[model samples]
Target: MRIRQRCGERARKRADRGPSGLSLLPWLLMGLGALSHLLGGQAPNPWIGAAGLLAFNTVYIAIVFRAFDRSRRESPLTWGLLVTLGLLTFGLAIGYGREWLLLFPLLGLGVGAVVRRGRLLPLIAFPLVVAVGAVTFWRDGWGSIGIVYGTFISIMVTAAILALDETVRELRETREELARAAVEKERLRFSRDLHDLLGHTLSVIVVKSEVVRRLAPRDLDAALAQVADIESVGRQALTEIREAVTGYREGSLATELDRARDALSTAGIEPVVRRSGPLLAPQTEALLSWVVRESATNAVRHSGASRCEIALSGSADRVRLTVTDDGRGPADGTPGSGLRGLRERVAAAGGTLDSGPAPRGGFRVTAELPVEASVPPEGDPAR
Candidate 1:
């Protein structure tokens, strides 16, 4: 499965590079023209005319293939080569038949595909080539009207090929730009997850280390127990980190509350948790859990507070969670990276998040999510 996916991606990347097989289109059209000429009527010297037509086709094919190549296109040498081919084909047609004149306009079309410096050259040159063919047919007085109509038809065909080539070029550019944007978005998500995971875990470990330092001299047994708890927390943090790397980790409000209480206790701060109203959906519960964990981590790591409070409440239409601590708030009112990411997450869930200093003291983070907001629809992955 993985191999197939990789192969499919490689194919798509190749397609996104540019249009393929463009050089063959001109030859295909020329082949049809040759078949039509052969079946139209008898010729004075069919073998000689066929040899001359084959030689013209060889030159036309080379010019067209080179015109489509981005590296050599639009060079002074390339346009000069096209002009030479056009004159040669026109001279050959004068001796062979009016049919050979049709090949001349193709040279103009190929040059127009590249060398945008002379944008009007093909429009001007094609009509002149058509007039020359029409005049030649007039001199012979055989199917004169048909010659005029065929000239215009050839011009239309050339115009369609040029337009298609341009559209393909634009599509390739847009595809590459979209791929770049997707990669940048994934990088941002991974960085945000790593910061949140490691930040909270490391903060808890620091607080527990402080507890061990204080208890070791007074109560060796108690300090040993704290060390054991620290070791356990470290192992759990490692497991969570691994899960986070694979994007399979899920947060729970209940689990965050338990860990927050333990972290507060280790930091010598009291924890008070309260929940009310109906239960929340799993997604909402997970979102709130992250908010609580981040808020609690900030309270323990930054704010020198003695108490922290966590509250969860739900109404018929909305669920709200708030984390508050009795500690000095942000000196400049600017939120940290975790809170910024939390705001984005909550908004994606059709929710709102607010954070600032409490009216009394310290910092407060609040989140409210719509209870009735339906899960993301089928084919619409979660944000």
Candidate 2:
């Protein structure tokens, strides 16, 4: 599968080169036809010389038809008929007189204008036709130095027009690529935001609903409180989703710690928090906040734990967080959705998170984040 994909990519790149390659074909045909004319002049038999010139013109006309067909704007059969007409004109040029040869280049220009239909085509073809006509007139004893000067001007104009066409094509392609990249970036950003907003809210709602089911017949007030907590959680989830959509979502370590405390207290588990960290980068802080929330949640929902601890410490270069709970670890022998999301968030921030059973008799989670202060030296002592 991988090999096939690589081959397909190479083919696409080769196809993208077609436009520039086709642009060079007309000039190559003209150069080769001119060479054939010169060589025919040296042939021993006049008939053989004429036949050689006819063959060269025929091949050039065939090439023009193929170029038009590849463009797909014109019908291949129509261009093929045009090629036939061009061949007849070449024959008439030879039979009528040598002066009639001047018409061939002009005919080529007319065919180019019809088939190419681009602004650059006329600009390139017009001058070449006039120059060929002037050269033929000079050969027939109607020459002037002004005709040669005009030919040089024609060549320069043709080159300038083609250069402009190439520049416009490059600019259009660059704009398309940039637009595609922006769309992809926005898609990824939204996906991450949705995950962050909905995952924990849904998990908490499920846990509370289960608890309310067990306590409803025994204690009506306790069931009502659980229902209220569910409503509050739902509202908070809606607010976070709105903020995420509006690019206004922000998180802090202190706020997450408070929530963690409340969750543990409600679960009848003692939660101990120890902090000794400098201010964290926004990305690191947000990620650590999510970690704290997920750890506390899993401790309540999955583990039958009596105690939990969350510890945070940081210096100038590195920060570490550890969450431990004394519980019967991982009942089903599979990690839950909360743990999976926590793993992804930490990994994305260039940090690591490990969660498994503690050898003594519980579950343990540890995370580390690296931070770099972006302030320049002596920028401001107090800002």
Candidate 3:
């Protein structure tokens, strides 16, 4: 029962790994060859020779299985057994006939598949086995037919097994590369979220902290209230950070617009926001909210403009957000990392974001998102 369970687990693992059925073909053919030998009355002691054939093929299958297990160290004992089996099969073929000679080259091929260091051995061993069979049969009155058949079978089997092995190795390497790419993608996402979340939150904290410092001596109560607000904002930032880590945090377009206005006011800039069209889907709204936050943050911190205008208007199938600030346009002809990261995010959501100097003056950030992207997933709580 334990052996059966182990076999079942192995089968499941093989299925999970890849379409590895090709590797089994060689073993099935070898088994069929053994069965043919037995049925054809080629062995003098049929039962004993059949048992020997089974034992050799079993060892050959084991060696092939070991080739796939990189974690397990290659056992020298296994290679020694292969050598011993090949010699024994050669002796049997010399005493009996050419049919037993096939097993000798088969043993060498199994060894070659497992032994990564001695790749040349199988090349030499297969041809030698064929040469020996040809010489023995030619001397025994059997002619070129025996030599050609032995050579063809030995070379074909060895080549087929090695080809299959190489294919499996390439597939495994490709899977590993894909896994690494997935990990890198996840890391980028984490960094982007942390930056978007903390950048705005920290900027607000700095502004409010400055407000408290200014009011501390002149207005004690107002300073104390500002300190309290700081504490509340810090706590909220902590909650949002935690949610962002778990990928559950959602944003609101209305909330972001209000915060953007407040942040602009604190920075001594006038913020004008206008919205039109029906309400957006939750995810789309959240993404647009992030745009507002990022735009407001950049306007306050980078752009030295005194006035910023944000316009949101689109049809039933689309939403457009245009943020324009009359600031010194592009500096050194490079967009900031914040905008670059935002571009990636927008693109992932099947949207387009264009940011550059406005023709009339200042800088402009315009984003257009599909209306369908706003729709929540079927089972989403927000839906």
Which predicted model would earn the best TM-score? 1
Model 2, 6-57: lDDT tens per residue? Answer: 9999997765543442453454353344445446564245565455456645
Instruction: Output the better candidate (2/3) by TM-score.
Output: 3
TM-scores, all models, native as reference: 0.67, 0.58, 0.60
- What TM-score does prediction 1 earn? 0.67
| Candidate 3 minimal-lDDT segment of 10 residues | 374-383
Give Cα distance to truth, residue 204, candidate 3, Å.
Answer: 1.2
Candidate 1 positional error at 227, Å: 1.3
If the candidates were sorted by their TM-score against the true structure, best first, what order would they fall in? 1, 3, 2
- In terms of lDDT, the poorest run of 10 residues in model 2 is 374-383
- By lDDT, the candidates rank as 1, 3, 2
- Expressed as tens digits, the lDDT of each residue in 256-283 for candidate 1 is 8999999988888899999997877777
Model 3 TM-score, all chains together? 0.60
Candidate 1 lDDT for residue 66: 70
